[model samples]
Target: MAKKKKKDAYIDPQQRELRELIELKKMQQAAAEHPEEVQAEFEKEEPIVPKTFKEKWKNYWYHYKGLTWGGLAGVVLVVWLIKDIFFGPEYDLSVTTATKYMFSALNDSMSSDLASYAEDYNGDGKTDVTYNEITIYLDPEAENVDVQMNAINLQKLMAVFAGGEDLLFVLEQESYDYVCGGKEGIFIDLSALYPDIDIIEGDKLILNDTALGKKMYLNGLEEDVFLCVRDMGGSVKEDDESLSTMERSLDFVENILREEYPDKFPAEEAPADNSSEEAR
Candidate 1:
């Protein structure tokens, strides 16, 4: 017996996991053999405690995905709102035009002519003028043009029709006729606004609708396309100070037309002086 000395068995720290696994397997085998005993033991053990709100939230974040995306979207929307409110560009005025022909030529001419016409109407030193374009398609029924006026486009059309003090529209012939058909509020009487406009001058482009009580400038190139300006929302009063800006803009338009399409729109001719001709 003295000669028989027990040798200590050494186990590595990493091998402790294997020993635990074997112990678990033995327990599982015992539980399978005595299911009733294992069930009673499990029932006797304390029930799992409910997770706190913080712990539950941590678990939820570990599993759920849409909530994280929703949070990010909310943050982006808030930032956009702040930026729009504080740093958004402010337009002194907006001009809307409807064209039947391709606008490339007219656009080039306009851009070249109006390049230096930017004015500080609001005394803000920045020129905030926006040019908007609308394409008109001929309607099959009435030989008039039709626009897909739905959603945002419809809202924009209505806003221009409403005639805001800072907004103007240069409408096409068929479009102008359709808008002025009701003569409700879509057009501002240019004659009333500028008594000296000479809209019917020979060298000037003009169109008349006696029934509709409207007269405007026709496109020199296209007979069916007319040019006319109306206050957006038609709310510009005769005595409004902004009328001066409107006048200047209209004059600018006339000058551009006269310059760009000189062949089509020439200078007005001087009337012959028949009475003075006898002295000659």
Candidate 2:
């Protein structure tokens, strides 16, 4: 007999069908028993919902719109208030008033009879002031001449105005005395005219003693009174009488300058000239 044929290792089709049928039956029974539990577990889970770009933007705007708009409005209001306070018409008026008073006092102090005569020395009905004995042209473009005079008079007249017996005593005693010593500087007693004036160096309205005399001669006064006072040095006491003398001297110089060089006198620029010119 030929060796018995080896049996195939693969399962028969009938057995495979039986196994599949048995698994199917077991799965159905398990599902029937746990249906309520499965339903409850699915119900406990939350569903996912995606957000759109538009919806996100709407949420952001709702949260921040009031804050953004309020901040912007606050900034604008604050800026407007600052401009109104500092750059408005009221501020301009205040400046104009201060300038007017300053110039008025200066004009009064310098307008002496001697000054007038010097101005009309040529008798041409036109004033011609001389600087350094040389005539300087007065033009509309010139800076304020009064301020120059104030500077010159302060230096030249300090001793005549501030030096006296009382001042000498104070100096001897090594005390810083500020008594007027019966003297009057050019700017003395004229406080009403220039309320804003200060005796500080480099100030536009204030003048040092040396600077006062120098400025006067430079502007066209022929008098050298200030030079004589300067030669005395700053040894004099600040007395009322000395101060008065200084004022008189300054007045005299101012008169001479105005008469001889009226063109150099500081006057307000006529408004008409500025009306048509371009703003600087």
Candidate number achieving the greatest lDDT relative to the actual structure: 1
Candidate 1 has what TM-score? 0.43
Deviating ranges (above 4 Å) for candidate 2: 1-228, 231-235, 266-280
Per residue, candidate 2 scores C-alpha lDDT tens digits across 8-106 of: 335688987899999999878877998887688789999743389887778767889999899999999999999977864321000011111122233
Q: Write the per-residue lDDT of candidate 1 for residues 3-32, one digit (tens) a residue.
A: 343221345656878888999999999988
Residue pairs clashing in model 1 are 162-232, 162-233, 162-234, 163-231, 163-232, 163-233, 163-234, 164-232, 164-233, 173-226
Q: For each candidate in turn, give its C-alpha RMSD to the true structure in angstroms.
A: 13.0, 29.2
Candidates' C-alpha lDDT: 0.55, 0.37
Error of 2 at 195 (Å): 23
Residue 126 accuracy (lDDT) in model 2: 51
Best by TM-score: 1
Per-candidate TM-score against the hidden true structure = 0.43, 0.17
